[model samples]
Target chain A: MKNATITALNHAMATRQPVAFAKNLSDGTEFLLPDPHAPEALNEAGRLALAADKSTTHVLGSESWFIEARNPAPRLVLVGAVHIAQALAPLASMSGFEVILIDPRQGFGNQERFPGANLVNDWPDEALNQLKPDMRTAVVTLTHDPKLDDPALDRALHSNAFYIGALGSRKTHAARLERLSALGHQAESLQRIRGPVGLDIGSVTTPEIALSIIAEIVAVRRGGSLGLRVK
Target chain B: MIDVEDVLSIAASWHGAGEQVAIATVTETWGSSPRPAGSRMAVTTSGKMAGSVSGGCIEGAVAETAQQVMASGVPKLLSFGVTNERAWEVGLACGGKVQVFVEPLI
Candidate 1:
């Protein structure tokens, strides 16, 4: 690996832009992906590796190249500092997510209550706007009140966040969807939310619910199936 | 060359300082390998090392190979573990096998 390759890959990572480093094992040739100068064959292989979010070996005829995908760290934005948020924040962090808890209320969003989380003291919409949730982000609205959860969900719906979850019952989710519909969110986009958020593991306690939520987030991120249990 | 943690930026800083450096990455693993693929370790000419390709099983040999790679400006793919034919060549008595790619940071 040349210092030039390391510098370019580091630059891409520092900028939080996804990049793939391709190395030809047989010839010791190295190149960065998304480079117009690189051969089209390697570029396509890099594209596939990045899209799959993994490091893989691609063979073209007799040449084999290792494509290492380096994407920005995944982030989990908790829109309410409720009980579930307290339980879920650390779990998300353990699961390799940069957990951020957003709540304007000082008492709820304080560092003492939720340790090891980036706390946002602004309203959910403002916080989400400033945070600029991207494709690597997972957003969850833990406050059941429409005043708090609705705006957060609205902002999340507009962003490129890969996972959007809300803490509520099935009936609560129906009403929440109706309110979002009134705000002009199309039905198709609204379907992206995993309401009554979390997989169906018959969770009854706060911790169990939090576990279910994290499991569901992991399931979505890994492209795993929930079958009928999610309903 | 040293087994520890993921320190890519640190390696870049060393390269910026004009130090000869080499990086080794665990590209493949079999059976009960201590570290999974993508684990990395960086070594400098001054013997400074960080990160681990395994749970310290083959870092010493990798560090030595990294210095050679830095000197030669060439890359090498090394395999270790009891399963490999030359497993004892590097002192990886562990049961699983791991392939590490070592290259100079030129």
Candidate 2:
């Protein structure tokens, strides 16, 4: 039954148009139009069909279709342009992500310091306005300063950004929560945050810390808790 | 402009399209070179390519070698030495040595 659905979807996607499955070879053939707003299963069919036949298939609105075909390159937005961010940005960029480094501190968030990076020297709220954080966005705040880190976390927790983490020690994280709570951020939203963010891999140096943070983000995005430790 | 990944993607794309392509890579470099070794330029039997192995100094020579490899269906390594006094004639400005691997990509 599942295979049938997938096959039907594939058939639809291939025509570069939409297609319908003959519930039975007896029901007669029907070509269904693909819904642009269809679910993943439906879109998967559309993509599979396109891949199958290169000829005899005329794609309509191909410009729009190609635009849709280009998957949104997920962004790993770092709110602090610190050393860890400097290292993490390049590594993430190489891994096929559009990395954005935002810091209001001019000295830290300049192009010279992070060549090939989309550097934004603006406050988190203002930056988030221009670069909207959707579910595809993963945000990490490493300012280590409450003033800089808190506002970013506030905005991130409310946005659809998938991964939201803040860097600091346990004590600092606790203090940060108090500040957020005082600012009226809901506890449930705060719960979504990964504090002292990163895999529990005794990371002490700047690079190691960056690795741990990146690993944790990957774990969350993959929908796995591989780094969780049993006390 | 052909960036590093764009070059790699073109190579992969050509291979996927079932074209015979040879990739010549500069694995090392020295002295006032525009591109380092490990830089790659791919040449297809039909003469389409992405990337550059040398700063354009030895590209013609490499292109010739690439065509030979495609015709013969064999991969080989070719090198150019800029240390030779007449190296400037070939295109190397400062004395440098470049190792190029010409292999038919599957």
Candidate 3:
């Protein structure tokens, strides 16, 4: 690898931006794609690689270039350090998400409660403001408290977070929606919230509920449809 | 979920130390391939290897090809799967085919 290529790759990796490394096998020429100054063909190749989230080889005439894409790790942000969160955090982490648990209450956000998990003991709104959820992020509010969950939902809805889910019963969600509507959120924007959060798995336990939530998040992330489950 | 940066850094350091290095990347796969596309493995001229291309099912063959790439300075696009008679010998009996591109780091 040349110094320029290595430097560009290092910068992209550090900044968590998606980039593609392209190499011409025939000529031993290598360069980083998406370079504004590069040829249009190469930039298109980079876009294809990033969109597919896979490495590909493109043959242009007699020239063959291999493009390898490097994408930042996905993130899952939970707005509550409750029991279901304790189960969901590790599950999401194992599923390749950088899990973050936020709660203002020290008793619930302690290390003992969430072993090997990243805990943010600040207020939910403040924590979310600092985090600034992006397209690769999934936000779930499990606190069920208006003070905690509502603020987090507001922040998540305003950001580019791919998935936003809130935990509550249908009646609770209706009341919550009324409150958010009063706060100036449009019905279309509020519809993004997957209230009653999770698939209809008939979950009665904390772990089961957590599983359904994680499953729903994965389904949404991978562009899978939420089909009705057979009994 | 192996970090691609780690593999690239290791390959760069090996090349900086004057050790010939080759990188084998999973370019494509069919059926139930364990590793996805873009998975990589770095191998040195001294037979030391890092990362994985096929989850231990075909590392030996890849490492051998990497050594050949290092010696010849030529890239090789190798394919392995259950259709080959040697697939059973190499433990790729899971009915998947993987295409690996082995190139020397120059």
Candidate 4:
């Protein structure tokens, strides 16, 4: 709780970086790992704490140290504020994501459609450029329009966004891939986009589809597998 | 995220005001613990507290233990569970065990 530690923690939260606080139980000595992304600066215990992404106690040479990880809030960027997005945004917010909805259409991106969510009234490409998706961010194109979804997908695929999903039928996804390939995107890069977004849940309603999408996003974020569900 | 910010900020303010402060974190959990391992609670010498280690199941015990830790300047690892028979009295009726580490923030 020192002033320097508080300042560094505030800075890390503001800048969306990961930090860890290590306290030696024996002497009450404290050290702050302000940058978990910089592996070269961390010791073995620090690296383990960062990889675990959890607060834990480790003992080394008769000294016990408690390492607490302070990670920035995860973020979700939804392109094309449609009905499914309206349903997904609140759910994502509840699941600890800073949700942002982007659309050029005023009617779709208005407060009425996305209440209690950050609405970006700009084109997908422009919005994404300013956002600059990182490793803690997930981008989903709920807008089936190729004009909107394609641009956003192009931006997300290139960035370090952890998850990229697009809503469409299998046939539509095939055509979408073809378009991106023609525009010089590699096959490996295009594979990062989870077309026909969301888990196969036999969804029909907007909320159901939103649930599936959120489930898939969580699975991808937590490094869980999308194995087949047995009857 | 808000919970973490609230706990840390309260701890910082208490320390700034020259009060002894201690933080108790849920280091491990077994079975159906309400809060996860990283859950934190901050306490001061004046008995003021922020955040929670469990869902009101063992906050009182942890807070009381935190005061002792702040006074003695020694960290304590306390555990509570249904198997110990005090779980019912402490309200951890969810059939789980939790280990909390209370340490002074100097």
Q: DockQ for every model, please.
A: 0.24, 0.02, 0.31, 0.36
DockQ of 2: 0.02
TM-score of 4: 0.76
User: Model 4 misses residue B102 by how many Å?
Assistant: 1.8
What lDDT score belongs to each candidate, Candidate 1 first? 0.83, 0.67, 0.84, 0.82
Residue A68 deviation, candidate 1, in Å?
A: 1.0
What lDDT, from 0 to 1, does candidate 1 have? 0.83
Clashing pairs in 2: A9-A45, A13-A46, A13-A49, A13-A50, A14-A49, A14-A50, B26-B37, B26-B38, B27-B38, B28-B37
lDDT of each residue in A27-99, candidate 1, tens digit only: 7888888889889998888788788787756788798777787776689999889898888987787776778
lDDT of 4 by residue, B17-84 (tens): 99889988887778888888768899988878889998896999999999898888788888887774
Each candidate structure's count of clashing pairs: 5, 10, 0, 0
Give the poorly placed runs of model 2, Cα more than 4 Å off.
A1-44, A47-70, A227-231, B1-8, B12-106
- lDDT string, candidate 3, A43-156, tens digits: 898889888877867886688777888777788999989989988987787786888899999988999988877889998889999999998899999988999999999999
Model 4 segments beyond 4 Å from truth? A2-7, A34-44, A51-54, A110-116, A186-188, A202-204, A227-231, B1-6, B10-22, B28-35, B43-50, B54-60, B70-74, B80-98, B104-106
Q: Which stretches of candidate 1 lie over 4 Å from their true place?
A: A81-94, A98-100, A106-122, A126-135, A155-160, A168-215, A224-228, B1-5, B14-20, B28-37, B44-49, B54-61, B80-98
Better of 3 and 4 by lDDT: 3
DockQ sort, best first: 4, 3, 1, 2
Query: Which segments of candidate 3 are over 4 A away from where they belong?
Result: A1-10, A36-38, A51-54, A110-122, A169-175, A182-188, A200-209, A226-231, B1-21, B30-34, B44-50, B55-57, B81-97
lDDT of model 4 at residue B44? 87
Candidate 4's DockQ is: 0.36
